[model samples]
Target: MDWIAEMTDEDTALWRSDLGLIADAARQAGDVALGYFNQSPEVWWKNEGRSPVSAADFAANQKLESILRAARPDYGWLSEETDDDGDRLSRETLFIIDPIDGTRAFLAGQDLWCVSVAVVRHGRPVAGVLYAPALEEFYEAVEGGVALKNGRPITVSTTPLDAPGRFAIAEDVLKAFPEALKHRIERVRHVPSLAYRIAMVADGQIDGTFVKHNSHDWDLAAADLILERAGGRLVDLQGEAPLYNRIQVSHGELCAATAPRLADLLRGIGERRGS
Candidate 1:
C-alpha cells in the first residue's frame, strides 16, 4: 500500500519520477538506433512508398516497448514501429512513440532522426522525451514543467513569425503550396523526422516547421508535447489542436512556431487553402 501511495501524488516530484522512468526508456531505445547507424542494416518500405521502417526501427521499438511495459504494465502502447491496436483505447495512460522518427535521414546519415516517446494522460501528452543519438541531444518535458535539452533548460525563440527565421518543412510541402516558397521563410531546410523538427523548434534551432497531411500520431506526439512545454505552439493550419488515438492516424497540415504570429500564419495558410 505504501508503494501504491508513493506512485500516486499531487506533487511535482511524482510527475518527475514517472517522467524520469520514461526518459530512461527513450534513451535506451536511442542506443539501439545508434548501434545500427551507418552499418548498412536491412531496410524495407511500408504503406506503399510513404512510410519506411528498418531493422533499426524495429530493434529500437522492441527495446522501448520492453522497458516501458515492464515498468508500467497497465499503460497501453502506440507506436509507429508497431501495428495499430484498438485495445489501447481502454487504458488511461498510453505510451506513444516513434522508434526512429527520421528513418530516411537515419539511413542516409543525415543525423536528424530521433527516438520519440510520450506518456499521454487522458488526451494530452503529460510527459515526453526525444532522444537524438546522432546529435547527442535529449529533449524532455513533464506536465507544467520546463522543457530541457540534455539536462539543461531550453526555451523557444520569441521572434515574430514574419521575421526572417529558419523553418523546417517537408520537401513535398513545396509542391502542395508553391506560393509558400515566396512567403519569406528565412531558411527552408528539409528534415526527415517530424519529431526532431518539433524538438528543434522547442530548442530554438528553428523558428517554425510546416507539416502536411498524412503525418501519423507517433511522428508528432512527443515533439508536440515538447514544443508546447517550451512555450511554443502547434496546430493544424486549419487551426485545430492535433488529436491522437483516432481511427485515422494521419494529421493534416500542421504548423509549429514559437512566434506570436503563429496563429496568423495558420490563418494565412487556411485562406490560401480555401482560395
Candidate 2:
C-alpha cells in the first residue's frame, strides 16, 4: 500500500500539522544560526576532533528543542546537538533534527548550511523541512504531498542513466567509478551539507549524490522525505530505505537519485567493488 493509503484521515491531518510545526521551527532555528554565521561562534571539536560543533549549533538546537518539544510534548526528540537519551525509540512518532547542517561551511561564510527537521512516524519520516536562511530557500514535504521549495513544486531530474549527468560526490568515491562511468558524469563541487546536497537532487539541480558511511539520522531524515516526495530515492547499497528512531542512528554508504538512475548507479558501484 502507498504511504497515504496506510494512514487514516486523522493521521494525515496530524502529519500535515507536524509539517507546519517543523517548517516554522526550522526557520526559527535558521534565524538563530544566522546570528552566528560569520561571527566565528566559538568552535568545539567532537567525535574525537573529527567534527566541529559551534555555539551557533547549540543556540539553534536550543531554539528547535524548546519550540518543537513545547508544542508537541508527547513526541520524542533526537538532535545532532542534543544527547540521545534513548527516549525516541519508545515513541511511535518523534522529531529528528540537525540544528545547523554544514557547520564548516557556515563558519567559512558559505550559504550552503541549513536547519533540517522532520517528524518520523514508526520508522520513516512523514513530514520534513529544510530551511536555509542565508539562501532564503525553504524546502518542505509531507507524505502524500508534492515537495516544495519556496512554495513551488519540485521534482528530481529525469535524465536517463545513459546520458551525462551532474552529481555532488567526493573525489575519492568518484575515482572508484569505472572510467566509462566517470566520463558520463560531471562531478559537481562538494556541498558540505549532506541534507542540502540531497535536496539539490530533489529539485533537479543535480542528478544524485553518494552519502559516505557514518552519516547519522539527523543528516538524512529530513532530506530523505523531501527527496522521496520529489520522486527520488535515497537507499543503502542493499536498496533498503533507512529506518529512523532505532537503536543505531548511523547509516552506511548510500545513494540518492531517481529510481532508474539509482539502480544504474548501484549496479556500477557493485561492479566496481567486485572488480
Candidate 3:
C-alpha cells in the first residue's frame, strides 16, 4: 500500500450510484430531441458530407450540459455538439456525451437515435448510460456491475463463435468479412446510431457490430461500458481496447462482440484489413 500514496481517485461505488443522475439527464435530453424528431427540426451538414447536425441536437446538448455540469462542477465535458474546450484534458473525471447520436436517422424520422453519456476518470469510463426515447430502452452500466436494459439486467448473445450469428454491420464493414464467415453471418439491417447499435450487441439482440473509422469518444464511450459489463467488448480491429478522453477524440476501425466471439471476430477483421 505504501508504493502509491498520491492516488486520489473517486470511489467506483460513488460513480455507480450516480448513474441515476446520468440516466435522468440523458432522458431529459431525449425528451428535448423528441420534440423535434419526425416533426422536422432544421438540419445542416458538418465535415462536408461526413455528418449532419440538427436543431434538436443543439437543444438536447444545451439541456444536458446545463443539467450534468451543474450537478458535478468538477467533471470535464466532451460532447459531439459542443466545441472542444481542451480544458477537459486536465480534469480527473469528465462527461463524454452525444446529445443525439444518429442525427441523420433522427432527421429522417427514424427511431434509432439516442442520448449517450459517460463519466470517464483517468481515461477509463467509470459510469455510463444510453437512452433511446423512441425505443424506450435505457441502458445502464458501471465498472464491475451488470449491464441493464430498461431496468432489467441484460447480457450478450451466447451464440457460439462458429455458429450462425446476426451481425449489425455497415456495408463497407461487411465487405471486410471473410467470405466463409460471411456465409454463416447474417448481416443485420443498418443501425444509424453508433450507441444504439452497440447496445443491441450488449442485450444480445445482435451478436456483434463494426464501427467505421473516425468515430469519436462521445459516440462510443457510454455503449462501450455497457457492452463491457454485459460480457462483451468493443475493440479495435487489431483487438486492442480503446482509451477515452484523449487529446485526439477520433478513433480508428473497431468491432464489438461478446467475449466468447471477440477473437474470432477480430481475426476475420484483421484478415480483411490485411487483404
Candidate 4:
C-alpha cells in the first residue's frame, strides 16, 4: 500500500504537528551554527580528511538532538554529527538531520548552508524543514501539504522542457551531455550545501541540479520532501525516489527537476552512458 495513501486523518494531523516541531528545531539549530559561522569554529576532519566538520556542526547537532528528542522520545534519531548506533532501524518513525548542511560554506562565511531536519515514517519523509539562518530562508513541507518558503507557497520553475535553463551541476557532468544540450544548460555557481542546492530547485531559483553519488539520508531527506511538494523530484538514475532510515543511508548519482525537465535530463544522462 502507498504509505501516503494509507495515512488517516490522525496520521496527517500528527505529521503536520511534526512539521511544526521540526521547523522550530531547524531554526534553533541554524541559530546555533550561525553563532560560530565565519568565526572559524575549530575544524576537524572526518572520513579520513575528505570531509570537514566544525565545532558549529556539533553545537547545532546538540541543539537539534536536545530539542527534537525531548519533544518526541519515541522517534529515532539519525544525524550527520552523531555516530549511528543502528538502533533507529527498528523504529517506525525517525528524525533525519543534518545540523549544518554546508559546513565548508559556513566556515568560509558563506550563506548557502542550512540546518536540515525531517521526520521519516516507513522509509519516506512525512515532514521536512530547511532553515538557512544566514540567508534568512526557511523552507518547509509536510505530507498532504503545499511547499512553503517563509509562509509563502513555492513551486519549481515553469521553464519549458525544451528551452535553455539554469542548473547547479558540476562542469564535468555537463560535458557528458551532447554538445547542443550542453550549450543549452547554464551552469550556476556552486552552492556548497547540497540541501540548499535542492531547495533552490524547489523555490524556482534554479531549474535543477545533479547530485553526485554517496549522498546520505541526512544530506537529502528534508530537501527531498520539499522538492517533491514543490512539484519536482530528486531521484536516482533509475528514476526511483529514495527510501530513508535504512541500514544503508547513502545514495547513488541523482537528478532533480520538474517532472518533464527531469525526464529530459535523465534521457540525456542515459544517452551519455549509452555512448
Mark the 10 consecutive residues where model 3 has the least summed lDDT: 1-10
Better of 2 and 3 by lDDT: 2
Give lDDT tens digits, candidate 2, residues 1-275: 26646788898899999999899899888998999988988999999999999999999999999999999999999999999897788998899999999999998999999999999988899999999999999999999899999999999998877788898989999999988778877999999999999999999999999999999999999999999999999999988998899999999999999888788788889888983
Best model per lDDT: 2
Tens-digit lDDT track for model 3 on 73-113?
Answer: 98999999899988999998899999999988898888999
Ranking by TM-score: 4, 2, 3, 1
Choose 2 or 4, whichever is better by TM-score.
4
TM-scores of the models, in the given order? Answer: 0.89, 0.97, 0.93, 0.98
- Alpha carbon RMSD to native, model 3: 2.8
Pairs in clash, predicted candidate 4 = none
Report lDDT (CA) for all predictions.
Answer: 0.81, 0.93, 0.87, 0.92
lDDT of 1 by residue, 1-275 (tens): 23323444574575677689889998989998999999999988887877677899999999998898898898888998888789888887788988999899999988888999988766667788999999999999987788999898888887765566677765555345436543655556677788888888898888888887788888888888889889887888656678777667788778998756576566556655774
Compared with the true structure, model 3 gives a TM-score of 0.93
Candidate 1 off by > 4 Å: 1-14, 170-183
Look at candidate 1 and give me any clashing residue pairs. none
- Which stretches of model 3 miss by more than 4 angstroms? 1-10
Q: Which model is ahead, 1 or 4, in terms of TM-score? A: 4
Better of 2 and 4 by lDDT: 2
The most accurate candidate by TM-score is 4
